[model samples]
Target: MDKHFEISLQNRKLLYSVLKDTPKDVLCSIPSGFKNNIWWNIGHTVTVQQGLLYGLSGLPYTMNMEVANKFKKGTVPEEVPTDEEIEAMKGLLFSTVEKAQTDYKAGKFKEYSPYETSAKVTLNTIEEAIIFNGFHEGIHLGTVLALLKAVHHPKAV
Candidate 1:
């Protein structure tokens, strides 16, 4: 496996750990301090990855822009997205990752637009996007963990 995929998988594993035991209430509840609930964070990250990789690669994005805009960085979650929509987003997230693995192995990204890492650094290949995705994933995982801890008390002996 390429190093980018390896890193991306590691980040995915961490996200799985965080999501595995998250209470449904926590997933759906939007606390005053958090921008969105755990579910929204997960969906937004997955949506961004699919859009950047699939959409930029000339493949149709499984997620529509209206849903994407709901969780776009600057947008506030004024209303909660339905459970059905969240489930659909989750399905797309899984399938997109599988498709991306095949696309990367087959060198399908040769024609995609170049992605910049940040304003200061530019990425010229899909490999860079995968690596950047890992970094972005970790950031959201940290936020989820912190929120989980903040909202609930740690177990005591």
Candidate 2:
């Protein structure tokens, strides 16, 4: 469990660096042939983690639903989020994981509702969900990197 948590933390550290370093314009730009941008990928990862680990466990999510909904699966960016929202999510990228660790230690997650993801993988436990979330985040991180490449090198798309 600690290894899983550590992997997640490390993944987020790399992700946070991307979020912190990317310019607002580049973060928001949906490059040619890309349906979503870097900001969506980053926010979506957090929302998916909350849904997989907390919401599936029948525990309240650490993220605000209003903000979470903006990044939920199948949703695209409707409008640029406020700078404050981006700042809030930047903090949540770590704080939420910290809270999940605390809750796990406290035995807060007792059960999880099984869910089959779009990729056809079903997660049956919080631990499985956490592991799966890492995979999911990695995919989004790749997408973010690809988007960055496309944004910088227009022909890359």
Candidate 3:
């Protein structure tokens, strides 16, 4: 569980770096042929992690419903987020995971509703959800990298 928690933290650090290094314009840009922008991918990763680990466990999510609704699965970015919202998302990228770690250590998650992800993987326990979230975060990290490349090299897109 410690290993899983460390990996999740590392993933969040990578995301924080992305948010820090990317210009606001590039982060908000939706490149040609892309359904969402860099910001959406990052927010989606946070939202999905919360849904999978906390929501499914019947625990209250770290984020509010408004934020979860905005970035949850099947929702496209409706508008470019304000600078304040971006800052909030950046803060959440680490804070949510830190809270989850503390809650997990406190044995807050007693049961989890089984769920099968769109990728066809089954998550039957909180531990499984935490580990699977690492894989999920990695996928979004790759998407963010591709989006950054496309933003930098529009001709390639």
The global C-alpha lDDT for each of the candidates, from Candidate 1 onward, is 0.65, 0.88, 0.89
Query: Can you give the lDDT of residue 86 in candidate 3?
Result: 84
- True-vs-predicted CA distance for residue 31, candidate 2, Å: 0.7
Candidate 3, which ten residues in sequence have the lowest lDDT sum?
148-157
- Over 61-155, each residue of candidate 2 has an lDDT whose tens digit, in order, gives 99899989999999998888788977998899998888888898899999999999998999899988988998999899889889989888342
**Which candidate gets the maximum lDDT versus the true structure?**
3
Per-residue error for 157 in candidate 3, Å, reads 16
Root-mean-square deviation of Cα positions for candidate 1 versus the true structure, in angstroms:
3.4
Task: Using TM-score as the measure, name the better of candidate 1 and candidate 2.
Answer: 2
Q: Estimate each model's TM-score.
A: 0.75, 0.94, 0.94
Task: Pick the winner on TM-score between candidates 1 and 3.
Answer: 3
